[model samples]
Target: SVEGSTGLIASLFNGIKVTQSTMSEVMALIDSSNTKLEYSSQELSNASKKLSESSNLQAVSLEETAAAIEEIASTIKQSSANAQKMTTHAQSVTKANEVGKNLAHQTVKSMDELSNEVNSILEAITVIDQIAFQTNILSLNAAVEAATAGEAGKGFAVVAAEVRNLATRSADAAKEIKAIVESATQKANMSKEVTDKMLQGYNALDDNINQTIGLIEEVANATKEQQNAIVQINDTVNSLDKATQENASLASNISVMAQNTQELVEQLKNAVSNTTYNELSKKRICDPALIFTANKLKSDHIVFKDNNFNNCGIGKNFTVKTHNECDLGKWINAHKNEKFAQTQAWNELLKVHEDVHAKVQKTVDLYAVGASNEEIFTYTKDVEQSATKVFALLDKLREINCENKS
Candidate 1:
């Protein structure tokens, strides 16, 4: 009976050891899970931050593109209006040219009629010359008859001489008038040639003007189409800008949720660490909440950095909390009497934490005053450096805490 009892007792001890070992392994798994969750949350926060930044940039670019398209549309509209005006002017010119062409035709007809009248005058002048020649011949016959009749024919001879003189003067006047008429006919022919050339030139100019009007009309039509297309493009750009802004808002929310999840995971890790079954496990499970808080702070700062101080969750009205008002600072204050607080890492952390807040306040002030992005970026670097130091110091504090707990 004693031997059986000893074996049962030994079996009971073996069972307890196994259970303790399983619990330790479970704790280790939980710790690993917590680490993985923290890492995954951080990665998600970073990704979402980048998405928000890209979306914002896309929105800005789309807005600028929309503005440019609007300007182009306006320019096209003006050009279209000008083209229409030109087309109207060209049409008016075409009408004027037609009127001029008509007038030119009338003038050409009048010149032709004048040439015909001049030709008729030349024929009449020839008839008058023949009559003068016949009269002169009749007068010579009378003179001859008078000479044959002696004294009685003397007075008739004088009247025949006077009639011959009158016929001769008529012939000279007819020749002078013919010369003037011939000169007038040559001038009329030249004028007709010039008018005909002018009429041809007018026709050619009319054709060219008509062609130009057609080209201008085509240009006007094309400009109108381009203006319509630009209007559509501007509408599309505005829609894209709206969508991008929505996307940015969504990304910002996602990043905030990811950070919240990370914080929750840290809390869960802390809760699990408190359930350790051994001193060694207790030492391994030091307070890492400050470390997680530092990580969150860094992630938040990254959001602001990535967003270029525009539309980040924090606004210009955001109050820049002092180090004492921050989570890590509060933790530090609560743990001031602790052994780790007296360490060099704690001192450095305090200094860097204050610097981080100072830089943040400066950034906010710059943003409030409408400072340039370059100026903000310069201060952002300072914040980044201080935040990095704070995180490193927090990690160091965590290590010191583990040692102190051990």
Candidate 2:
């Protein structure tokens, strides 16, 4: 029978080894799976980080493009300003040329009047020459007539010659005046022609000025358009920059989540490694000897009063509450099954609880039956004292079980 007992004990140990090996394998598998999950989370985080970086770069590029657009708009504005100034200058030149043309026209009219006056003076000189010639001829005839009168006739002839020379000089002066007037008229006509050409040139310049104004207006409009476009670009770039910043923030959060996941995986692996169960044979109380020991002190008699000992016609009160009826039913069912009925520790613990209940119930019954408070207290104290011994024994048994598990 000792040999059979030893064989049973050996079999129980073997079962324990098998259970431990199985638990270890499960823990290792959980660790590996956790590691894989953590690695996948980290990969996702890295991808997010890269996407954030790309977004940041795109934001920078957008900003640069916005700045470039702004620069082009500024240049357009400057060109427009220059065009406006040029248009103003062209208009001033055209006005000045118009004033010059007016002055030239007036000068031509004055020159024509001067030429007419010169012609009138020439006519007057011709009339005077004819009168002088007639007078000179009359003087010569008188001189001839007087010749018969000696020296007096000779003096008259000299006077007629001097008068004739004076008339000749007057005629020469009139001819010079006529020639000067003719030259003046030609110059005035040339001046008028030149003024007309200048006026035409001024007209052309005016046309150019108008064209320049139109061009400048076009440039101004273009500049305004460019400015508006640049403003839009700036706004877009700012939005992109903000989005990139948000993306970066999101990436940071994702990275933190990945790291936390890795840590959680490690914690899960450790938790799995720490959890284990004893062999099935050792987990229960199944021996006939243990059953006999537990049944020795069992009683069905119920006490009317509640106490720390004996049956109180009530179910056992657990210190900790279960979640629901399902959990309670499962625990109760498991206990009723008593699959490990040979477990000595379990039998002994149940016996101790039964003994304490019986003692406490007896005290409560005494108190209910008009016993003094001091007597009830003394009886309860003795019952508690016995319960303490039982607790010590249970603690030692648990320690032995822990040592065996280790």
Candidate 3:
């Protein structure tokens, strides 16, 4: 009976030792879990912060894009209106050309008629000259007959001499009139030639003006289409901005939830440290939020690239934030005096961040100067690469923090 009782007590002692070993192991696991939870919570907080910032930035970008689209639409409308006005003016010019051409035709007809009349006058003058010549010959014959009659025909001889003088004067007058008519006919022919050439010029000008009117009409139609496209783009941007704002709100909520979870974890850890064995509160750890800022930055760059390629809208007047103006930049500034700032990783991050902004600025300048898309894209890629390096450096800094904490 004594041996059985000793065996029972030893067995109970072994069971107690095993139970204490299990509790120690459980406590060690709790400590490790608390550490991991703390780290995870910090990471979650940071991710949430980045997401909120990204959402805000996206909203701003969308708003600015909408404003730019509106401005472009307005400009297009103005261009359309100007094109319409030009078309109207061209049409008016064409009408004036037609009127001038008609008047030219009428003037040419009148000139031809005048030339014909001058020719008829020349014919009449020739007939008058013949009459004068015949009259002079008749006068000469009459004078010779009268002289033959001597003194009896002396009075007749005087009358024939006077008639001969009148015939000679009439012939001289007819020659002078024919000279004047021929000079006028020559001038009329030259004027007619000039009028015909002027009419031809008017025809050529009319054809060119009509072509110009057609081109202006085409421009007006294209401008109208551009305006419509811009309006649609503006609407799309507004809608996207609204969604971004909602996402920002959701991020804020998630941040709050993460903080709450962290607090609950702290309480659980404290409770576990106090009790040897008790019901551990089951704490729910939420999934980590995505780091949206990096992706959003990349997306912004892509949009800028597309704008550069398309050569439209805000692309013409693209503007970028300075490194110090971004959320990450501000965070870096806030932590400048921290231990991580003394590390090479932090310095590299700073350099890479600045390089990213510099590259973006360079691309924007290139776009402004109408650089080729390939050139601009090269710079854009540099910016994206720099941005990626900056993030990697940031992760290195976080790792440094974790090592220091350990």
- Best-fitting candidate, scored by lDDT: 1
> How do the residues 136-226 of candidate 3 rate in per-residue lDDT, one tens digit apiece?
8998998999989999888988898888888888889989998998899898889989999999999899889988988898898889888
RMSD vs true structure, all candidates = 24.2, 15.9, 30.0
Per-residue error for 348 in candidate 2, Å, reads 50
Please provide, for model 2 over 100-181, each residue's C-alpha lDDT reduced to its tens digit, 9 standing for 90 to 100.
7677667667667766776686677678767766766776676677686678677766776676677667657666766776
Off by over 4 Å in 3: 1-37, 152-155, 276-406
- Model 2 ranges with Cα > 4 A deviation: 1-40, 111-152, 269-406
| TM-score of every candidate relative to the true structure | 0.61, 0.52, 0.59
Rank by lDDT (best first): 1, 3, 2
Q: Write the per-residue lDDT of candidate 1 for residues 155-224, one digit (tens) a residue.
A: 9999999989999999999999999999998998898888888889889999999899989989998998
List lDDT for all candidates, in order.
0.76, 0.57, 0.72
How badly does each model clash, as a count of residue pairs? 0, 14, 0
